[model samples]
Target: MEERLQAVTTPVLLESSAAGFSPWGSILRAIPEAAGDVPALLALAVEAGETWPRPGEGRTSLLFELLASVAAIDVAAARVFEPHLDAIAILSQAARTDTADQPAAAGSAGGTSWGVFAAEAPGARLNARPEGAAAVLDGAKPWCSLAAGLDRAVVTAHTDDGGRAAFAVDLRHPGVRCEEPAWVARGLREIPSGTVHFDHVPALPLGGTGWYHSRPGFAWGGMGVAACWLGGAVGAARDFRAGLLAGADAGREPDQVALAALGEVDRILAAAMQYLARTATHIDDGSLAAAGQSTWSEAQRVRGTVAAAVERVLQLVLSNRGPGPLAFDERYAKRMADLGLYVRQHHGARDDAQLGRLTLKGDCPW
Candidate 1:
């Protein structure tokens, strides 16, 4: 296992540090130092265009590997990179499912960082109405990350038919306006998710109504996010191991409690990794949706499982390693904090409740 990926990225990026490499090698290596530097991170992201596989391409594991590698390096960088890659996957999916009139080609252009702004907020809704061969967007779309920084995004809006559809938009349009985020979060403070307002902004339709959520790729893309969560936990575990190694280097042997914590963390991470790997295989083989299972349910399971591992790993690493690292080690501190908040994308128990309901409807994996 390599130090960076523990066998996830081998045969993809490099066999070893001394083996052959690609441009992605330097970009992945530089992400750690670029934490808290959003522009630098976005620059690195643009430099590595379309570097990941679209979901369900039979190489979905490689896609997960790239996402995990980025999160393993820096969670904040993953915050910027994951959605960019996800947007690409979504656009590619549109090309496959609905290509007659889609301008999704714009999303595939090089040197562009794209976002998928599908989150809805109270009192904010974007509506798209057809105007001749084009569509016009008007209203507010909330929770748009990097709205002002990114060159373009795939924005979902209520179509004239009373259903939601995804559209590609150039963020640089004159009718587009981004509101102040009033940012206050410590984690991902560099990447503020503000609301973007559009007034007569022209949009290129990407997919049919509700295709954004209806596609199996939706679930696969979500599991990719969980892979990022897995990587963040890997980062946390590395901190614990680094602490133990430093103690041993100073002739201070690790106590039983510290060793036990490390053991438990390894167990949790190993299980999480295997689960993600299995799910990736199912996705590639077209079995993720088998046995009357919903892809949404399986993706939720991935998120919930990985989120639990992240929570426990953070606890073990914090309790065993003590406060000295959090107080003194800036990089380590940021890693822990960023992972803490990013895993909340899992939706915690609410997701569990939804999964339970799904299970009630005969969607249980077991």
Candidate 2:
């Protein structure tokens, strides 16, 4: 993960020494060892913000490659970095200049951690009511990941016209309070995603209703998350491959079943990677529309393809590797657990249904 990711993002990293040594090289290599340290992940996120450019701004491939690399090392660390970077891209897409309050992407004070909280649930809702020249958030917004540790967030809340709007709010404000982190999930344990309450928390509106999702960058952001899933699948498959090699190294003949599983994984990963690369080119060149494609439909295909590949790879690794790693190896078990949980962000059949609808509307390539 470190080697490939470093190579992919090398051109974009901020050089710190005459010998072209990058501070990010140290950070990228150190993140996996950091495990789930919140402070450490935040520090890495800050470094990533200052270093990485916004996706669809000419280096979208690097953005996806970097995300895959971080996720390959540690999903928990990527959990902290992904949303922080996405928030900056959102701010950039809105065409508003970031100020001292907003900061530049991720580098900021120790307390300036950021997360994106836009997941909605019935009854547990956050709303932005009109307040003269501004808006005040009220009610509960569920799944506000790391809200307790994060100082700021780009959150989507309901508006008065029954549409949703995005807002950037200071989580440190007195009116905001993170509910007790009741997160008991074994995967991504470092990131506590629960409810956060806002009692008249003043928020600066980011975009009007429909502006957030309708923008082209929204598809790019979704694809960025898919890259993380793709990376997690890659990491899982790599471990399985290593186990097969270990038996061969010990003078044991390679099992054909394991070899077959590895071959399938190779195909899955290769196709998914190609899809991401092609779509990223479309995004950078503004060719999706030129080629009679919608960015949303293209994003759906990449996400669906990568997510299906992840599920198949996971099944193959678990079936072929047996229970040894899950039972005895801490790193292997944690990686599988994290991958299993994190990939659920794909929304399964519901997303497939969306893509199916797009195809029916003739938005998909046959």
Q: Please write out the lDDT profile of model 2 over residues 33-111, one tens digit for every residue.
A: 6767887888778678777868899878777877777777777777888998998788778765352255533345642
TM-scores, all models, native as reference: 0.90, 0.91
State how far residue 176 of model 1 sits from its true place (Å).
Answer: 0.8
Model 2: per-residue Cα lDDT at residue 306: 90
lDDT of 1 by residue, 1-366 (tens): 246443223222111132433444667767756767887887777665445566788777767767777888788888888888777777777873232233433333336777889888799999999877668999999999989887788889998778999888888788999998998988877788999999999977877788888988788878888888888888778778977998999999998888889999999988888888787888888786666788899999998998899899999999888889999998788888888888887888889999999999889867
* C-alpha lDDT of residue 116 in model 1: 81
Over 4 Å off in model 1, which ranges?
1-24, 96-110
lDDT of each: 0.79, 0.80
Q: Which one is best on lDDT? A: 2
